[model samples]
Target: MESTAKQDPTAFKRIEFLVVTKNAELLSVSKDLVEHYKFRAEYSDSVDTVDADTRLSSSPMMILISLEEIEGLQERMKNLQQLRAAFPRSHIVAMVAGDESTDDCEMLRGSGARYLVLLQEIKNSSKLYYLAALLVQGTYIPVPVSDLFPSTQVNFNAYHKLVLNQKFLPVIFSGFTFSDKKYRQLETAQQVYVRREELGEYRKYIETYHDQVGAALKKRCRVMMMSLMALYSEILLLLSLDCEAGKKDLVQSKVSEFVQGSQDLGRYLKDCPDVWNVIAKALDFQFCRYERGPYILAYAVYISLKADWGQMQDVVMTALLADLGILDLTPESFKTLQKKNEKHLKPEELERYRHHPMNSLNRVMLRELEVSNETKSSIVCTHERNDLKGFPNQSPADKIPAEAQLIHFCELLDRRVRASLEDGILTHDFVRKQVWEEEKDSLKRFNAAFLDKIEKVLVA
Candidate 1:
């Protein structure tokens, strides 16, 4: 390690820190802190992987270490001692287990730890931020950061779903108010995504009420939805592993869970437009270009529109199973084919691709999942356009059901958004106006009322 006496005055003002731990959750949040708040950060997975001299070479102003048992008590203490000896001037915030006692906390503190937080605090962003701020300012005490939040949550007054948030559509999509096509735009967008206000737009809707009852309900809804997504991913992975031998009961059971649970969640989100809209947006954005993306997006769109629970379930069922017929195609190859213009494909290949809707419907029927006639119609008509431009069958605008129209609109919107994210750059003003134009233009080919409903429930 370099001599500390030669350090310049300006060097003292520039704070950098090293975090040592293998905890994914901790590492993730720490990274968020570093990027969003502009902190200097370095990471080491475990004490053994790094030497004290190497750790101190950079002369970080602080060190953040976790309490997960590493080689036992004495060895862990020895590691801490080495870090303290190497950088005597730096602070160490040791994340201890939740079950740690006052004595244990004091012992770690006595062993050169400057601050302490319970392991559970890692999940609470607010607490993490509070602690980080305190430590940076050289004001944090060696005590646990627990029960810091007020019993009542802050009011959900971030923005109006049907009005205010529409202004931030492009910002929400890419986190910046600049065109993603430019270098600066992409860089800024990534940083801007973590701003509290940006997150507030989504959180305000997800949590419409700040009261205890509303909070409890919100937690339940979020957890259930996450579980449903996990189930979908698991099912997709299993099917891919062995299409014939995939666990049918598991898939059916998980599907049943999502369907049954959605009834209550659907009703809960009916009046909370922002909550469900963001939920749908996130589901579509994160999972797009994958097998389950469309399904989750359809489910989100259905609930956001305040459709009946039974009807929404049918939409989800169709969405999840709609692409099943094309499962045999390699994803890479399928994506490549999709990238090509329709006119470039051979007639037989185009015909084969177009028949996937019917194939999906047939596959679900073979599974004997008790799908409704309405669900069957949705599945078969997923590719049908209101302007008679769709493949397999070209149904007129009036003939397409509102349900099918909603699914189609969502599907197209996700594809377009993903494309923009990849190929173009946009700011809030640019994207909002663009979305409005596109939605208005869509009226020529889609049902006016259906398009209006979509814009109101989603974009607005």
Candidate 2:
């Protein structure tokens, strides 16, 4: 039996969530479930009341609405759309009757709902509340691998017989998975697989819930590492599946998010000191995982400098596409450059390598990306020096962008660190000495103002 008493209005004070439904039973259950998960929520009898409540100081972080009415499903969906328009950042969960048509589920998804919860299942199962908690918090939780997926030993027929519900399970961290042992960290990307599924299912999941999925996956990774993974995976896709227009759009969208996230992280890290070492260690791990050492090095320094949002965006775009020209090189030429030693390259190889910045700019243009003029300049001038002694074009000191100057210094530092690592030197000590002691004079190759910013970050 469910309580029918109206929840006291005073209970809504300081609440961070709202549950909207005409059913008194659902109101009682939802209130209990949310409070059980340590979230305070207020109940509303209808979406109309929620619309009025939006004028309050703090909007709810999540809105759970019941859409089980077959007679007025369309009206309920319109209410959902209105709520979505009003609270764009709120996580909208639409509760259905589990046995609804696929078309109805799709409509619910299309109506701006971030999650679809079966009403009967929620009422009967304790475990489903945990899932609801995850949806509301947008946080990661490690679950047994078997709980989230069909048995790895299952045959084709047996696997097919399993429900498609597993596809909706948010079980992975980017390309990797965890061991079933209690809350273990990620082991390897190779250990996970979902076999013989139609691509449509994957696409549908990505379209509807990719952002929330990524948010839930952010446990060990902060913004920089996430941005690196996004760029790395999308670039791999672009390289392999160049014909996929949808992938290209995804890449562009991810780049924009990366910029926005970087801005947010920059503000957060500005007040913290001596935290860069920990961040560097995490970045080094990502570098090893993604095989993107230069990007990691540039990113580590880039975030530390705490550039304005506009400059950060331009520099990040440059860092991502600066080396894309290496993709155009022959395998042998690419391998030569991968050594991070230009002296080893033959004259022809060296010439081609020098022209890679221009090639990268050309690649960006060919991709039809909507980058700003500043970003274009940064990519082309990434290798140019303020001393007027660098690059294929030998662009003058005044011609270089400040964003390009920072990237150039980081690239130079990355090569130095890699060379020292090859000689069995510790990276941390080498970087400290190289930046503060040996590179004091070399810093003149960058703009004085830009170098001052780097100096402050290093000393801090």
Candidate with top TM-score is 2
| Residue-by-residue lDDT tens digits, candidate 1, 1-460 | 1122234444322335577888888787777656544565567777566544445344455678886756556666777887788767567777766555556655776788766655554553134443454344322111111101222233212211113111111222323222324334334232211222123233343344333244445443543454444445444333332222324787677677656655555555554434533343333222223433433543454444453322566666665666655544422234334454345656765677788777667666665556778888777777787568885678776666555665665565555555555565743334434654676786544666665655544455
lDDT of 2 by residue, 1-460 (tens): 2222214443333334677887666676776666555565666667777534343433455678887753466886797898788776566877776665667666876888766765554554332343344344432112112223321222211111112211222234332322354223223321223221121232233233323222322211233343444344345335322222334576677667655555544543454334444344433331232245334434444444564322667766777777766555543454455443667888887888799889778867777777899989888888887677678688988888877876776666655555565577676554755664444666446766666556655544
Error of 1 at 68 (Å): 43
| RMSD after Cα superposition, model 2 | 21.1
Candidate 1: residue pairs that collide: 179-425, 179-426, 180-425, 205-275, 206-275
In model 1, state the lDDT of residue 77: 71
* Residue 263 error, candidate 2, Å: 3.3
The parts of candidate 2 lying over 4 Å away from their true place are 1-227, 236-248, 264-274, 283-290, 293-310, 418-430
lDDT of each candidate versus the true structure: 0.51, 0.53
Judged by whole-model lDDT over C-alpha atoms, candidate 2 comes out at: 0.53
Q: Candidate 1: which stretches are off by over 4 Å? A: 1-225, 236-248, 264-277, 280-304, 307-310, 330-332, 337-348, 421-424, 427-445
Candidate 2: give the clashing pairs: none
TM-scores for all candidates: the values are 0.46, 0.49
